[model samples]
Target: MSGLPERIERGFAAARQIADAVLLEGYVLYPYRASAAKNRLRWQFGVLVPPEYTAQGGEHSHQRTECLMEARDGDRLAVELRFLRVQRRTVEQATAAGFESVERLELADRDLVEWDEGVEERIELLVPVEELAGEGVQRPFRLPGVGETGLVHERDAVVGRVIRRREQVDGLLWLRAEELPGPYRAQRLTVEVENSSAWRPSRHATRDQALPRSLVSAHLLLGLEHGRFLSVTDPPEWARPAVERCRNERTWPVLAGPEGERGVVLSSPIILEDHPRIAPESLGTLYDATEIDEILALRTAALTEEEKREARGTDDRAGAVIDLAESMPPEVLDRLHGAIRGLREATGSTALGRPEQPWWDPGDDPGVDPERDRVLVDGHQVGAGSRVLLRPGRRRTDAQDLFLDGRTGIVEAVLHDLDGSVHLAVTVEDDPGADLWRAQGRFRYFQPDEVTPLDGTAPVEGTAALDGAAPVEGP
Candidate 1:
């Protein structure tokens, strides 16, 4: 941001916040230790493998993101490329002669294990909108190679040493723009990122060997000083055709910042909706494993002291997670459990016979208790105590409904959707999961047209042997 134009850096505070999360999506996984098997496999997304090695067949050597924009004269486009560069950390123990590279160097305080660490890197360039209009711009860039060594000491003697090595990763960026025929002056912007690194590997080299030359978790953030970018995922009706014509390869572009703000675009490998925001309830990133912060924090807290110590030594980010988990207060951990993003005027029974109500908001829908609500189905009154024979035939029904076609279930509730259709939630009598689903306030929803009214709420005695077939369909 230091070199970027002031306006380009203005509203990007929120955009960068989200992009940073994307960069660390898979940096590390559970049990965050160098020895952890899953930790060996990192950088799961947006990996542009070296071209020569990619010819052997694996992830592609490039990614392309195309989006639509509305810009005027004098508008400048700011492009910021961010990615993780793999830094190989090797531990070496001090020998009588000199230092020797060892898999692990054990110290009194902690263990130092050889691991691949991700170092954040960014490239910023501001190009005028005019430059990207006609033939556009194409340029080649390189992430300069680096190698460094740090001495490890204890008391007076230097017991061991650590080596960090990184190979150069070369890449190319191509930006092209075309004026589209539309109601307004619109342009299609295409950005292509390719990994053209010349590093070649030996026969049958593992992916780990290729990391030093590869682009890990690559993504781009585009800012418009005066113009606005359209939402690629949810374009307006007039711009749908143009948005569809844009071909995005491997990566997608989404509107960034608050909802409806189109000044910025976050092109990433992960699929997300427009205006994607990190939940305020989230304490911090857990590196995209399950994304259940509570569960990950709990598991992190449960790690043995020895394991925790190794995790802390694996990487700075891992150490931060370890410290966060250990120091998180109980109330803060509870905040991670649940959150209500927002609420609206909710209605009753998302699917009853009358005007449908929202099932999510509990207290809004008055006089519509599932236990007391009754609806007429096939000229028969059916409520929470009524029984029915399922005959599911809806075109959108799940395949499992075929098994429930003839099964008998007791109606648990009568629900209604916004449409004029009615749905009866029922629990199958013989289902092993019936109790579990019922306790969770879930039931199999059957429309009035999908079920036949059956007599009595109690299970027919001595007739459980009829299998799922309706037993003596009584009036």
Candidate 2:
């Protein structure tokens, strides 16, 4: 655990954190449902659909992305591209007999007709074109189509074709550029990735469905040598200025805009991370933690009762699936618990009652009393010098950097804001170099809701706890 594996594990953890942030960028829950009034804007990042195609319904089009690449003379490089393919399909609902009348039928009186829903088809091809060679003479290379096999379900069917191969396809696209043409210089390269799919009318179909489109969460992964990975979710320091400017203006100059403008405005960051080496070998692999997580999450959610039982009983991947199913969000867990309770009630098996400690229970202490502007630890008040834990489930942000979720810290001061909001200034125990007392100290102010007081035998330090005999207030 203390060697290359450890480093790789840490890298994956960091990558996962960045991916999680990107995963929640547009929507909060699973299924990535689109709401016109909510998720109104699509193609937030890495949008490549041409304006003409977009104007013509954008059902079928090619999307490409350009990035800056650097390599020494004659150095080989590998590039991996990862993105999500979102498909839309029509679902038909059945009504009970005589329920499709002037008046709406009651829940008990109406029965929904069940029909098989076909899976939407989306095809993606990522090609690293020669635009990176700096206007040099072209050398053509042809590659044969790759064939793959998988379960073909007519119901909810999804088919992917690459270079006209009809088969199930992996989501990742890779391209390798061998024998670099230049030495240790920055070069701009373009990756031409295309999505192709068509919607066909069906007997129960209400409207013509659009072809499947790609949704990039801006979580591209670049795998460099020596187990190092560059996460494109957050741009590197050098690219931050440009990314920030684009983010501030809510537009980007990459994809064509609605009015046929050369660039599309962005509402989020266009992250980029470059490798330190010059023209390293392109691994030609795609690594996306969030995409993997999403697949597992959806699979777990779609499991039937019998399948779930089998999963719980089986070993290998089936058992792992059960574990993933149990790892849903707190809100989802609560809903599941309510559903289980309802099922138990319907079966008249109240003998088990409710478990002594339900899975969704958050335990006794509620952390903060907003009205009192004070911290409570298991029903006890917290004072200066008392150790405490930051509340979990907070959205990771700049202001929350000083305190990590579940990390314990020492309370340096407790103060009130102008609006009567309580703010706790704490110095993280692990961060000994933190300047807790200064105005610009490493100590950060947190809302009472952000921290939970921990039990301590020592008495409160009182006014002496103040960094300079004056209490720091306000953000």
Q: TM-score, each model?
A: 0.77, 0.30
Query: What lDDT is obtained when candidate 2 is compared to the true structure?
Result: 0.36
Instruction: Give each model's whole-structure lDDT.
Output: 0.82, 0.36
Error of 1 at 182 (Å): 2.6
Instruction: Compose the digit string of candidate 1's lDDT tens values, residues 1-475.
Output: 6766666686587788889888999788888987888877778889999988886647788999999999878898888889999999899999999988887777765678888888898877788888886778888898788999999888888999889999998998888888898568999999999999988777787788888888888999999898899998888889999998999998989999887788899999988788899888888878855478999999999999898778777877888898899999999999998998788744544344465744456456674566676665544556777778888886744898788778899988777655646678899989899889999998888876677779744334454333322212212
Off by over 4 Å in 1: 348-475
**In order, how many clashes per candidate?**
11, 17
Q: Model 2: per-residue lDDT, tens digit, 1-475?
A: 1222332334334443333344334332222222213233344444332223444453323433333344334333333233333322222222343112111111221211111111222222222334234442222222222333222123364221111122222232323322223443334333334333222334343212221223344233322213111122354566444334321121111211122211111112343232111111211111222234444455566866545543332212333445556566655544433222233333343357643543233235244322233344344455467678876335546755743777888776666545645567777777756654534654666665666656644333453232212222221
Off by over 4 Å in 2: 1-17, 20-52, 57-75, 87-184, 196-208, 211-219, 226-475
The candidate scoring highest on TM-score is 1
